[model samples]
Target: MNLEDYGEGTLASAPLDVLEDYFAAHGWQSERNGDEEIVAAVKGSWTQYELRAVWRAEDRVLQFLALPDVRVPEDKRQLVYETFGLINEQLWLGHFEMWAASSMILFRHAALLDSASPAGLTLQQAETLIEAALDECERFYPVFQFVLWGDKTPQEAIAAALVDTAGEA
Candidate 1:
């Protein structure tokens, strides 16, 4: 979790070394800051995401966070919280949370560094997690907007955004 794990003259940590390679292969702009963390910018349909992946060797956990390009207003914090709870209920993988200090909604997922992924995680798993995070953000972005500015309740906002369509409109 710190520079000590990386040792002198080491550019990156073990798990993050693998993740750094994954970022490079995809041509995403990423910087492995020191060792334990890598921050990348990824574009989603709805907005750009600031992707942060952290490797905690002590706990054998890889924490991933995708932050959608929106900031919740102070007045709508309560509704945003409620909508996020509903959104979390519908999600099977990662969940949405507000980083209270910034009021930024984030999609968070964690993976155990196990035998399957010796380097904390594999590229395929990373792809899946990233896609899921982006998809969820794209789908729910408008709902957040509705609650914040369109005079819609949290339930109403979710209902309006979640309706399924048959084909291209």
Candidate 2:
């Protein structure tokens, strides 16, 4: 995505197409953006998680599906936003709800990764976790229905495989 090109202090909002291109290049797909929201899928090993880039007053922000359920520390969310070149403070200002901005899930993911909980995550289990997370994401943020990262089948297949693996385990 060459996010470095955007740099800091750029007042211009990242166009939806540009965001799509960046995510697409990373193997993300099935993007759906409307007047108020943008949604897509992301690949995590063998599973896919839904990612929502909600528009906040013409500025684009990220929100993940099913992240509210994940426990994470504060400050981590802001780092995720920084990684994408979005101002985390702007997205979080005055928003008391976790789902209102993209930071919460990112923070949780970061915490999880840092803590090594995501290590040794099988493809099937990973898909199941992402699916569960997306369910929460949809419940909290309904304006999402895009496919980014990998195709829908891989996600479903990973989920199914996880279920089978669980039975065996």
Candidate 3:
């Protein structure tokens, strides 16, 4: 029910439980969607995104996906794609993609958890990955908005996003 219940241990064997507890510990409302999936919603300053953590037993990896509420219109597909290319390169951990068939955009990352490896999952690692995905979503959300609704060119949107704001501080 909580992080305290699960003492520090190798998560290679119980990644799902570890992840569920981790999300719960962080006060994120989550529920098991099926045997190997947990769906959670995280709110950002711009919007809320649904984060899904799915354990692929066959591959021994935990795949996390975040889908923002923004949808790319057919006409804006090229602009959105161009914007994602720039954003994806800047990402160190995960990548963003536009699913044309679904007309949805998602941020995705994976953590390998080979049971035989000495390195096991840690709360810090999981947290870092999840946060990275969310941070990417938050950072690029406005760019997508600019392309989708603000009638801004992809180049313009990216330039606006990359403007240095530390000086404003």
Candidate 4:
């Protein structure tokens, strides 16, 4: 659907707006940029840092865009990988990782609906929506699997199933 359908200046044009409001209700000020990015304060049990959500909508399709956290580098990407594991360990903690984890869930679930059985989505005319969504989720790292297994790789069984179903969309 186009932004206009949601109404001018309405929250419909941006999913991040919903997320920002959700965070703000919890006492956090979610700063948005260019209608595509959101950065917020994250409080750990004993520490705090800025958490960011970089997102984009292109060709009327939406995906969770990655933030350019320059503070995180190549060597630190490994640290972020390990941080993925650490986040799993503290899944219940209210932190940036928690938001990431939650965001992953929301996106992936919507992707599933978009791809396998849109049911009633207007985009059903576009058969590749599900595959596109899965492709994006896979690229972004399936946080659900990361949380459950502490690894970025999908389970062999799931990988094989996905591969088998790859063209079903």
Best by lDDT: 3
lDDT of 3 by residue, 1-169 (tens): 4344445553434667776777888888898866578888778888988888888776888888999998888898988888888788888999999777899999999998756643345677778878898888988888898889999988898888767767554
What TM-score would each prediction reach against the true structure? 0.86, 0.30, 0.86, 0.35
Which runs of model 1 end up more than 4 angstroms from their true locations? Answer: 1-12, 115-117, 167-169
Clash pairs for candidate 1: none
TM-score winner, 1 or 2:
1
> Between 2 and 4, whose TM-score is larger?
4
For candidate 1, write residues 1-169 as lDDT tens digits: 3324444444325667766666788888999877689898988777889989887777877788899878888988999999989889999888999999988989899877673333546567777777787788888988988998898998999899889889887
Candidates' lDDT values, in order?
0.80, 0.36, 0.80, 0.38
Off by over 4 Å in 4: 1-13, 59-169
**Where does candidate 2 stray beyond 4 Å?**
1-14, 58-169
- Clashing residue pairs, backbone N/CA/C < 3 A, model 3: none
Models sorted by lDDT, best on top: 3, 1, 4, 2
C-alpha lDDT of candidate 3 relative to the true structure: 0.80
The alpha-carbon deviation from the true structure for residue 166 of candidate 3, after best TM-score superposition, in angstroms, is: 3.4
Q: After superposition, how far is residue 87 of candidate 3 from its true place, in Å?
A: 1.2
Task: Point out the higher-scoring one by lDDT: 1 or 4.
Answer: 1
Q: Against the hidden true structure, what lDDT does model 4 obtain?
A: 0.38
